[model samples]
Structure formats: structure tokens, C-alpha cells
Target chain A: MIERLKDLWAHRELLWNMTVKELKVKYKRSVLGFAWSFMTPLVMLLVFSIVFSILARGGDVQWYAVFLMSGLLPWLFFVNSLMQSVGSIVANPGLVKKVYFPREILPIAAVGANIFHFVLQMLVFFVFMLLIRWHFSPWLLLMPFILILQVVLTLGLALLVSAANVYLRDVQHFVEVALTALFWLSPIVYPVGLVASQFPKFMPLYLVNPMTNIVLLWEYAIYNPHHYGPQVAYISFWGILITVVFSIVTLVGGYYVFARIERGFAEQI
Target chain B: MEHAVEVREVSKMFKLYHENVRSLKEKVLFFRKRGYEEFWALRDIDLDVEKGETLGIIGANGSGKSTLLKCMTRIIYPTSGKIMTDGSIAALLELGAGFQPDLTGRENVYLNASILGFSRKEVDGKFDEIVAFAELERFIDNYVRNYSSGMYIRLGFAVAISVDPEILIVDEVLAVGDEAFQRKCLDKIDEFRDSGKTIIFVTHNVDVTREICDRVIMLEEGRIVRDGIPKEVVNHYHQVMETEEEASEQGNRKIEITEVRLLNDRGEETNDFYTGSSMKVRVCYEAREPIVDPVFGFSLDDYRGFTAFGTNTALKGLEMGTVAGDGVVEFDLKSLPMLEGRYLVSVAAHSRDEQTVYHWQDKLYQFEMKSDIDDVGLLYIPCEVKTGPQAG
Candidate 1:
């Protein structure tokens, strides 16, 4: 695995070029260009805040728009990265068959392109927090660490699905359906307290999902944890620890599966 | 001699599944083992290529020539054994294989060069030379999707040749481009050869193998059948192909042409004759049952597949009497008025009264004609020189 990282490092220029090409091609002829990236999550935030704040009355959380935006941006990044990376190998059959390079570069480049959009959306979230007169906390500095963990987890899944999709095209559809289910299962649209109160026994199983911890960490960074009571602060610490372990395991497992099937990709694709 | 490439007992096998389950429902519903067959594309192949030697591989379709090339370049790994190469290798398997149509020619050149393992600085250094070689100076900024097919091929060839690798693998990529560009590309290859670069060329064009390759390997049915000097190997490949064709044709025989012989004017069987000499083609056939009015004919073609002359008994208003078991029909040419070159003879028997062709053999027999006088073009017609003052 170290050797593979070294190989990828040697081809860093190729990875960078491919990522830039993806970004350029995505918004090549459009007049709105990069604005679409911010527009998508913001528009989703608007619709969710309207529905949840008016209908459900936010339950007990305040500043619901800020809570929704913080989680929605990261979720969009994860889902978009997986969707693009899953088809990356099969989509470039011409390159896959003709050239010799680290096959993982395709998926890694897809994740890198989406990371650009993720960072942009985070900036928008920061601006919204300031407008809502949210307090500044030194915990915001730790947000990068959490973001890195999320990226690692996403990269692992992307590698596995991209390589597998070369052999089984149904992987793309499976991922689409799986992402929808995962979105509702995680605490993206509603608060984590609602799930804990409704099913206290099932909360342990629900916390095992890496996205659950990731979304809570984003909330911890954006919203002051003191306002959420003692129970919320205690869960955030354990959630961060579980997310770290889960990210490492997923990344390692995904890399192993990707390496095993990559040798046959030229023939299968 | 120092070797540039070495292969020992290498083989590749591909599994052919009875049914490829592309969807989850198909996999879940089918609760039995999926049947499959294994196909061996290369079997325990062993060979060595010395440094600077242009080795040519020739074979019929599906004879594993491209598979061996791909294996050598590591595009696909072998199922067993080992292969080793000494230097940086570049392969041109298919022209324009990675060019994105939406990008401009300038952008694509950089992108394609990088994919071929050139660094950004290296491409920057060679960018001008690549564009000049491709002759796309004025249109370099235009998207490749708008470029003509010829322009696209030129650009692809230019970018491929610009990268100077220690070893090059070319698989019939020169089959495209116009005559001038093809010649230029071949010239560049020759220059590379002079610089002591190892080249592996795979082509079906015998003339190219004879012209450029010092050594040749002939593959058939996933095994090496012949390997030696270009002349002998090419001859063996042609003979093997002819025998295979005859064996396959024999399986579906109604009125089979058992033997075809070329006889001289003195009734001596020979494939070598002088230009303008009378030659006869004797086609001996066997009939499984009695048949009537079967047209017998033969065509004479030059080495380039240009037909010099063709005539049948029906076209000449000649009739052959019916035969039951075995008989021979002979075509006697008054003069073989063709230039000094190797020519192929094809024979056919038709029952179509021009409708059904019972048996047809293409380029089945080859003959050589010699001439003392120097001449050009496909045919040499006898003419009387009458150089005199113009008549008013």
C-alpha cells in the first residue's frame, strides 16, 4: 500500500490534470459555471428549512437553516463523488485499454474534483453562520481534521465501486438507491436528538454509520455545542472517535478490494 | 548480443462465460453455476528480441499477434510465466485511442502526451515540434471534434512519434494516413532504428516485413510456428495460409478442384516463365456426381491485387463436354504479356450459367515471370515503333 501511494505520487501531475479537466468540462458552456455548485446545496437548504421549520417546528434545535446547510453540503459532496467515481473506469474505456498507469487514479481524481465543490460550499456555510450572528469558536479549526476523515471514507467507497462497476454495471444503480436510503438514515435533514429519543436502543446501531458521526461533527463545529445540553456534548466526543476508526477500516478494506479486481479491468471494460 | 526484451513460457487465458450476468436480479434468479470455457490467447510463448532489431510479427486474424503485443507492453498481464524488458517502452496500438473530442488540438496534444508518460515540462519542450510535424499550425486552437479525419490522424501520429522511448511497439498503426504521411512516418521509424531503438512491428503487409524487419515470427493458433530471417518466415507464413485455405475448402466440396498446375509451352510443370511466353493453366477437378455445363476460368493478378487479365471458357465461347468422375480443363494463353513481377492465379468453377459459383479459390497459385528488357506498369503490350515525319 505504501508503494501504491508512491506510484500515485509520481503521477500527481496526471491526477491534477484530470481533476482540472473534469471541473472544466462540467461547466464548460454554462453561463453560471461554479455558481451551480453553491446554488444546488443552498437551494436544497432553502426547501428543507421551509418544510422542517414550519411543519415540524424544528423540534428543539434553533437556527435550523444553519444546521441543515452544514450537513447538506458534506452529504452532497459524498454522494456526487461516489456517483462520478463509480463510472469513472467504464466511462474512459479508451484510456483504460490504451494507457498504462495506476488504475486508481481515475477514482481518486473524481473525489478530488468533488472536494473542490465541497470546500466552496463550506465557505458559503461560513458566510451564512456569520450573518446569523453565530459565535466564533476555536473548534472551527478542527473542522479540517473532520473533513479529512470524511474524504478518506468517501475515497475508500469510491475505489471499490469504481473497480467493481467495470465488471458489473448494476453497481451504478445500486449506489444510487443506496445513497438515497443512507441520506434519510443519517441525521442530515433532522436533528440527532429526535432519533435518540424515539429509539434509544437503536441509537447505538445508528451511530455506527460513519456519516452519522461526520454530520454530527459538522454540526458541533458550526453550532455552539453548549446550547445543545450536556448529552449532545458527550455524544460528539464518542462520535468523533468512532468515525476515525470507521474511516480507517473502510479505507483499507476498499483499497484491498480495488487492488484485487483492478488487474482484470482492461479485459472486462 | 544484448537483449531488449525477454519472454519465457508466457501464456494468457481468458474465461468465456456462458452468460454474463450484468444485473443483480439476473445473478439472484440464476441459482446454478454459470458455464464457461477458457480460451488460450497465447500459450507458453518464448522469444527474445535483441537491442535495435526491428522484429515483425505476422499471422492470420485471431492468431494472437495483438495479444502478444499487449502482453509485452503490460496492457494485459499474462496468466502464467514471465516477461522482462530493459528500457522505457511506448506502444502505439491504436491511433487516437485517448484523444478527447471536446478538447482543442493544442490541449489534446498535451493531454495525450502526458497519458503516454511524458511530463508537463517535457511536453512543453516538444510542443512546437509536435505541432509542426502534424502540420496543424493554423488549426491548433480548434477543437478536435471539428478537425477532419485526416487532420486527426496526423495529430495522433505526430504526438505518438514525438515521445522518444527506448523501445517502441507499433501494431499496424501505419495502415491509416495518406501515402505521403505514411512514407514520412516510416522514415521517422527508420531514423529511430538508426538510433539503436528496439522496435516491435506487427503487420499483415508482407512487403513491409520484408522491407524493414530483420527478423520475423509467425504465430498460428496461439503458438509460434516459424521464427527466423524475414524472407524464410514470410514464405512459411504464406505456405501455411495456403494449406489452411485448401483444407477448409475441401470440407464443402461439390465439384472439387483436386490440383492446379502451371505448365510451360513444352508441357513442363514450372512456376517460372519468361514474359510473352505461352503458358497453360491445367485445373484438374473431381465430380461427386455427373454435372453439366460448369464454367471453368482463371484470373491473373499482380502482387498488388490488380488483375492483369481474366478469362473463362464461357466468356471465350468455348464449351467443355460433361464429365462424371474426373476430368481436366486447360486454359492456354497465347502470350503472358505482363511485366516482370510475381503474379497470383485464382481458379473457379461456376454452375450459375452465371448464377451459382460452385467453388472459387482466390490467389491460390503464385507464379513468377522474368523479363530481359526493362519495363514499367502492370502490362507490356507489343507495339511497333513508327517514329517518322508527321503526315500533313
Candidate 2:
């Protein structure tokens, strides 16, 4: 894994070029362009904010908006990155067949591009909080740690989904349905706190969800510091552990599958 | 003291599919439909190249020439083979494989050069030399998409030669560029050859093969049919093509040419029919029809399959009313101007335009011109060159 990391790091220029190409080509002829990256989540955040405010029966729901934003932000990054990377190898079959490079670079490049978009949105998230007087604590310094977790989780999912997609292309379609289901299963719209009270039996299962801890930590760090206590630390620790393990397993497994199947790709393509 | 490259028992098989499944749904259901064909592009190809050796590969289309080069470069892996090389390899298996239409010429040159394993500093070091060699210095900043195909070829060739690789693999890239650029490329290849570098050139041009290659290998249907000195291999290749043409002609019609042989004064199998050499083109044919005014015409074509000169018995107003049944017709040319290359011959029998006994045997016979004399253009247009201290 360290050797693989070193290789990817050395080939960082290729990643930069690919990421820039993807970013430009995606919105090439569109009028909205890069703004669409921000516009999409902003639009989703708006609709979710209105509905949650109405449902929670009117309180100072600024925290509620921040909560929803935090959840949507990471989940959006994961979904977008996974979808793009799942199709990455297939999309660039010409490059893969002609050149000899690590196949994992394709998915990692997509993940890097998505991370760029995620960082841009996070800046907007900060402005949203600044508009309101959401108190910032020393806990905010750990945003980089949370961002790293998000990147790792996204990378793991992208690697797993993209690799599986080569053998079983049905995963691409299934991923969309799974994502929609996961959206509700995660504490995005409402809080995990609400879920614990509403359905006490499923509370432990919710804790196992990597995104649940991620969203919970993001909400705690930004919206409410009092809530960012031992639980957030515990959630962060587990999140880091699971993501690291998931990343390694997905990367190793994906590389094996890619190298094994790559020879057939030229003929298949 | 040793060979620059050694290839042992190299074979490559490619699996080709009828279609590419781009969408996920199509990919998932790909197994339901089954029509795949396996083709052996190369088989049991063994070759050895000494240092500073120029090896030419000559073959028809779909022969294993390009595949062998690709295997040596590791661009595409061989199914079973072992290749040992002494130094770095630079392959021009195709021109313009790495250029991006969206990028500028300068940008694409850098990108493609890097992809070909030249470092950024190396490209920078030879950037001016490459641009000057390509003759695209003025338009270096223009987007490659806007550039013409000639411009693209120039840049590709320039960048490839700049690598100065120890071993260079050239495909049919020279077939496109203009005459001047072709000369430039040939000169560059000669320079590389003289500088103790190894080159593997794949081309259909027999003359180029004979002129530049120390040795030539003939490929037919994914196998090496002949490998030897350039002149011998090329002669054998021409003989094979002539035989195949004769066989095909026999299969097509009632009139069959048993053989078409080019002979000197003493009748022996020889391809070397040079300028001012007494040559006989003997065509043994069997006639199935009652033939009258049977006009037999033979043609001399250059290496490119273009008829250089030809005339028939009836066309020349020599009324030789024909009585033909298993006879041989010979065309004896006194002096042929063609210099130092292979030439193909074709024979035909017809009375007039409508009633044809037999038609064009396009590749019936072949001969070679072994001249040390220099020819200015495509053909030797009898010329005189006098040089001394320039008299103003």
C-alpha cells in the first residue's frame, strides 16, 4: 500500500491534468459551468431547509440548515465521486489499452476532482454559518481531519464500485438505487438524535454507518460545540479506522481485479 | 561486438469483437451474444539485430510487421515471446498517436514527448531542435486541431527523432509527408543508422527496403517466409507474388499462363534485368478458343505498381494475325531507363477492345534493376551532371 501510495504521489501530475480535464469537460458547453457545482447542493439545501423547518414546527432552525448542509455536503461528494469513478476506466478504455499505468489512477483522479468540488462547497458552508453567529471553537481546527475522512471514504467507495463495475456492470445501476436508500438511512434530513428516540432498536445499526458518524461529527463541529463531546471523538475515531481499512481493502482488491481483466479490455472495447 | 536486439519465438494473438459495449446495460448483457474471433497477428517470429544494423520488414497489409514492432516496444504485449534489448526503445509504430487536438502544438509536443518517456527537462533541452526539424516554429502555438495533417505528421516525426533512442521502430510514417520531408526523414534515419543505433523499418516500399536495410525479412500471413540479405529476400518476395498472381489468373479463366519467367541470354531464373541488358519475358499460355489476330501486350511497372512503359503487337500497327495454342510470347526490351529497384510486369491477350481472350495479369512477372548509377527523379531521365570550381 505504501509503494502504491508512493507511485500515485509520483504520478501526481497526471492526476492534476486528468482532474482539470474532467472539471472542464463536464461543464464545457453549459451556461452555468462551475457554478453548477455550487448551484446543485445550494438548490438541494434550500428545498431541504424549507421542508425541515416546516416539519420541526418552527424554532431557531439555523442549526437545522447547517446540520442538513453538513450531511448533504459529504454525501454529495461521495455519490458524485463514486458515479464518476465507476465509469472512469470504461470511459477511457483507449488510454488504458494503449498505455501502461496503474489502472487505479483513473478512479483516484476522479476522487481528487470531487474533493476539489467538496472543498469549494465547504467554503460556502462556512459563509452560511458566518451569516448567522454560529460560534466557532478550537474543534473547528480539526476540519482537515474530517475532510480527510470524507476523502478516504469516497476513495474506498469509488474503488470498490468502479472495480466491481468492470466484472458486474449491474453495480452501476444498483449503485443509484442504493444511494437513494442510503440517503434516508443516513441522518441527513433529520438528526441521528431523532432517529435514536424514534426508533430505539435501530440506533446501534445507525452507528455502524460510516456516513452517520461523519455527518454527526460535521454537525457537531460547526453547529453545536456542546454536542461535539466524547461522542464526536468516538465517532471520529471509528470513522477514521473503518475508512482506512476500507480504503486499503478496496484499493488492493480493485487493483487485482483491474490488472486481471485489463488484458481483455482492448478486445472488449 | 554483439547484437543490439534479440527476439525469440515471438507470437501474438488478438481477440477481436464485433462491437464495443459502451453503456453499462449493454456491458452486463454482453455475454448473451457470442461472436468473437481470434486472429494470430504474429507467430513464431525470430529476429536478431546487430548494433548499428538497419533491418527492413516488407509485407502486404495485415502482415505481422507492425505487431512485431509493437511487441518490441511493449506497447502491446506478445502472447508468447522473449525480447532482449540493450538500451532504451523509441517506437514510431504510428505517427500522432498521442497528440491532442484540443491542445496547442507546443503543448501536445510536450505531452506526447513525456508520454514517450522523455523527461520535461529533456524536452526543454531539445525543444528548439524539434521545432526547427518539424519546420513548425512559426505555428508552434497554434492549436493542433487547426493544423493540417501534414503539420501533425511533421510534429510527430520531429518529436520522435528528437528522443535519439538507442533502438527506433518506424512504421509507415514516411508514406504521408511531402517529398522534401520524406527526404529529411530518410536523411535522419540514415544519420541514426550511421550513429550505431538499431532500426526496424516496416514498409511496403521495396526500393526503400533494398536501399536502406542491411537485411530484409519477408512476412506472409503472420509468418516469416524469408529472411536474408535485402536483395535476396526482396527477390524471393517478388517471385512469390508473381507465382500467386499466375495461380490466381489460372483459377479465373480458360487461358492459363503456366509460367512467366524473366530470362537473360542464357535462360535461367533471374530477376536482375538492368538497363541495356538483353532480357526475355517468356509467357507460356494455353488457348481454349480459336484465336485470330491474337494481340499480346506486356507492361513494365515501377515499384509502386504504376505502368512505366508498355505497348502491344496490334497497338503498334504490326498485324500479327494470331494462331495460338500452347505457345510463348516474349517482349525483348533493348534498354530500360529504370534504376536500382524492383519492377512488376503484366501480360494481356486481346484482338480488339470487345473480344478478349485474356485480360490483365497485373502481377504476372517481376524483375530488378541493379544499377549503381544515380537517378534524379522517380525514373532515370537520362541526364548529365558536370561539376567544377563554380564559374560565375
Candidate 3:
């Protein structure tokens, strides 16, 4: 495993160049260029706010638009990276056949490019927060740590799906359906308090989802803590710890799966 | 000399699917003991290529030449045995393979160079040299999608050559681009060779193999048939092709070439002739039934399988109305203008209308031409030069 890391480290320049190629190629002819990255999450935030605000009318939700945007941006990053990286190996058959490099670079580069968009969307979100006159907290520094955890989790899933899709193309479609289902399963538009109040028995199971903790962490750092209540904040604190452990496990597991199947990639792709 | 590459009984097996099970549904639906046919693309082949030697591999399509190169380059793993290489290897298996059409030529150079395992600093140093070699300096900033196919291949080939690899594997990429660019690439390869790099070239052009290779190997049906000096191995490849073609020939049984002979001035059949001497090629044919106005033709090929001269009786205005039974056609030349080399004579009989070919024999008869005068080239043109300054 250390050897594989060293191999990948040795080819870090290739990974960087490929990531740039992805970013450049994605917005090559578009008039707005990379503004699309910031615009996509903003647009999703608008649609979700209009729908969810009407649904949660006369409810105890404050600044639901800001809450939805924060969660939706990260969710979009996760889904988009997986969708693009799943086909990264199969799409670049020419490179896979003609050249020799770490096969994992393809998927990792996809994740890297999407990470750029993720950071850009965050910057845009921060500006919108300032416009709304939101409170500032030193705890906002913890967002980078959460972002690192999210990156690790995203990389693990990207590696798994990208390598799996090479052997079984159905994995791509499977990921699409699974991501859609996972989107509603996690509380991106709705508050976790509603789920906790409605399904008291399943609250623990619901909090087990890493995204639950991720979204709660984002809301805690960006929004007022009283909105979440002390009890919800207590569970979210432990949820963050569980998520950290889960991220490490997934990352290691994903790396092994990727490495085991990478040898036959040249012939299979 | 130490061997640059050594292959020890290397073999590769590929699973040939009747239907590609690209999806899980098919794999489950057609669950069986054996889902695919096994194909051994490379047999247990052993080879040792010395450092600084230029080796050529020649074979018919699907004869495993490319498979062997892939194995040596580690693009594909062998099922059995082992292969060892002494230094960094770069292969031009397919040109411009990883190029993104939407990116500019300059961006693609960096992308492609890094993919070939060059560091960013290395590419920056050689970037100008690569563009100049490809002659794409003006269009470097333009998107590769706008470049012509020639420019794409030129850039691809240029980066591949500029990497300064210790061992280079070229597989027919030079067959693309214009003739001038091809010559330039070949010159670059020659320069690499002079720098003592090991080159393994796979090409169908025999003249290229003769010009560049120090040794050559002929592959047939996943096995090496001949491995020796380039001249001898190429000759063996031609002979094998001729025999295979003859084996597959099924004539219509109208007229069959019974015997073909090369005769000297003495009118005696001989396999040897002297340059600038009178020679005759006699072809005898037997007609199963009566035929009309059959055109008899013969083509002369030099040792490298290049057609030197060819003519048909019909083209020469010879009228043969009706022919039956056994017949003979003789083509006589005042002087054989070929240089010292082995040559092949191919004879064919066809209707004067040129629709129905009675029989066509390729490389049916072989002959040797000897030259006492020292000259280099395929043909010897008789000429005398008398030069004086300011003759006018």
C-alpha cells in the first residue's frame, strides 16, 4: 500500500495535468466558463428553497435557503465526481491501451477537478452568507477539516465505482439510481429535527449516515447553534466522530479494491 | 554486449468472448462452465535483443508481432514466463492516443508528455524542440480539434521521439503523415540509433526494415518462423507469403501454368544470369479446353519484393487468336538491366478482354542476376560519362 502511494506520488505531475485537462475541457466552449460551477449549486438552491419553503410553511425553519444550499453544494460535488469518474477509465480507452501510468490517476483526477468546483461553490456560499448578515464563529475554521473528511470519503467511493464500472458497466447506472435514492435519504432540503421527531426509533440509524453528520456540521458552523438545539448538536458531535472513522475505513477499503483490479485494466478496458 | 531486452518463454492468453459480456445481466443469463474461447496470442517465445541494436518484426496481420511488442512494453501482461528490460521504455503504439480535442496543441503536449512519464521540467526544456520538429509552431496555441489529421499525428510522433527514452518501441506510426514528415521521423530514429538507443520497429515495409534494422524476425501464427540478418529474414518472409498465397490459389481450371523457366542466350534453362546479358523467360501453359486470345504476362520483382518491370503480350500488340492444348509464350530481353540480386518471376494468363484470369502465379520462378561492375541500386542503366569544363 505504501508502495502504491509512492507510485502515485511519483506521478503527481501527471495527476495534476490530467485534472487541469478535465477542468479546461469541461468548460472549453461555454460562454460563462467556470461560472457554471458556482451557478449550478445556486440554481439548485433556488429550486429547493421554493419547493421546500412552501412545504415547510408556518414551520420553525429559519433561512431555509441558506441551509439547503450548504448541504446541496457538497452533495452535488459528491454525485458529480462519482458520475464523471465512474466512466473515466472506460472513456479514456486510448490512454489505457497506449500508455503506462497508475490507472487510479484517472478517477483521482476526476475527484481532483470536482474538488476545485467544490471549493469554488464554497466561496460563493460564503459570500451569500455575508450578504444575509449571518453570525461568524471561530468554529467556521473546522469547515476545512470537515472538507478534508468529505474529500476522503468522496475519493474512496470514486475509486470503488470507477474500478467497478470498468468490469461491469451497470455500475454506472447503479450509481445514478443509488445517488438519487441517497439524496432523499439524507436530509438535504428537510431539517434533521423533523426526521428525529417523526421517527424517534430510527433517529440513531438516520444519524449513522456520514452525510447526516456532514450536513449537520455545515449547518452548525454556518447557522446559529440554537436552531439545531443542544440535544441535536450533541448527537451531531458524536456523528462527526463516527463519520471520521467511517471515512478512513472507506478510503482504505476503496484503495485496496482499486489496486486489486487495476492490473487487468489495460486488457479489459 | 549486454542484452537490452530478454524474453524467457513468454506467452499471453486472451479470452475471446462469443458475445462480450459487458453487463452483469448477460454474464448471469449465460452462466456456463466456459463463457469464452481461449486465444494464445503469443506462444512461448524467447528473444534477446542486444543494447543499441535496431530490431524489426515483420508478419502478416494477427501473426502476434504486435502482441509481442505489447508484452515487452508491459502494456499487456503475459500469462506465463517472464520479460525483462534494462532501462526505461517508451512505446509509440498508437499516436496521439490521449489527446483531448478541445485542448490546444500546447496543452496537449504537456498532457501527452506527462503521460509518457516525462517530468514537467523535462517537457518545458524540450517543448520548443518538439514543436519545431512537428512544424506546428504557429498552431501550438490552437485547439487540437482544429488541427488537421497530419498535424495531430506529427505532434504525437514528435513528442514520442523527443522523450529521449533508452528503448523505443515503434509500431507502424510512421505509416501516417506526409512523406517528408515520415522521412524526418526516420532521420530522428536514426539519430536515436546513433546515440546507442535500442529500437524495436514493427513495420510491413520491407525496405524500411532493410534500411534500419540490424536484425529482423519473421512471425507466423504466434510463432517466430525466422530470426536472423534483416536481408535473410525478409527474404524468408516473402517466401512464406508466396507459399501461402499459392496454397490458397484455386484456378478456374481453364489454363494452368505448367512450367516457368528462365533461359540464357544459349536457349538453355538456367536460374542464373549476368547483368547486361540477353535473357528470356519461357512460360508453358496447358489448356483444359480450347480458349481464345489469352493474354500472357510476366512481372519481374527484385529481391525485396519490389516490382522492377512487368508487361503483357496484349499490351505489346501481340495477337494470339485461338489457342488449344499445350502452348508456350517467351518474353525475350536484349539485356537484363537488373543489379546483382535474387529476383522472382510471376506469370499469369488472362483473356484479352482482361475479365477472366485463367491462372495467376506469384513468385512461381526464382532467378539470380550477377554483376561484375560495382554499382549500388535496384537497376543498372548502361551509360558512359565524358566530362570537360566549359564544353560549350
| Location of the lowest summed lDDT over 10 successive residues in candidate 2 chain A | A227-236
Give one digit per residue, the lDDT tens place, for model 2 in B56-155.
9988788888777767765567789888788777778666665667677887777667555566677889999999999999999988888999999999
Lowest lDDT 10-mer window, candidate 1 chain B? B243-252
Candidate 3: segments with Cα more than 4 A from true spot? A227-238, B247-392
Please name the candidate that would achieve the greatest lDDT relative to the true structure: 3
lDDT of 1 by residue, B1-392 (tens): 36899998999998888888777788778746666799999999999999999999999998899989988987789999888999888789877777877788988888787777777898889899999989999999998989999999999989989998989999998898899999999998998999999999999886688888889999987899989889668866765666455422322356788899999989999989888899999999888877678888899876555778999988988776675788888999989887666677888887736676667787878887778756666678776778889999
lDDT of 1 at B170: 93
| CAPRI class assigned to model 1 | acceptable
DockQ, prediction 2: 0.19
Off by over 4 Å in 1: A131-133, A227-238, B31-33, B239-392
Go through the candidates in order and give each one's DockQ: 0.44, 0.19, 0.55
- lDDT score, residue B109, model 1? 88
Per-residue lDDT tens digits of candidate 3, residues B266-307? 998898899889888888999999898889999988645678
Candidate structures ordered by TM-score, highest first:
3, 1, 2
Q: Evaluated on chain B only, what are the TM-scores of all the candidate structures, in order?
A: 0.66, 0.67, 0.70
Model 1: pairs clashing at backbone N, Cα or C within 3 Å: B352-B355, B352-B356
| lDDT (10s digit) by residue, model 2, range A104-168 | 77788898889889999989888877887667767677778877776766776777777667666
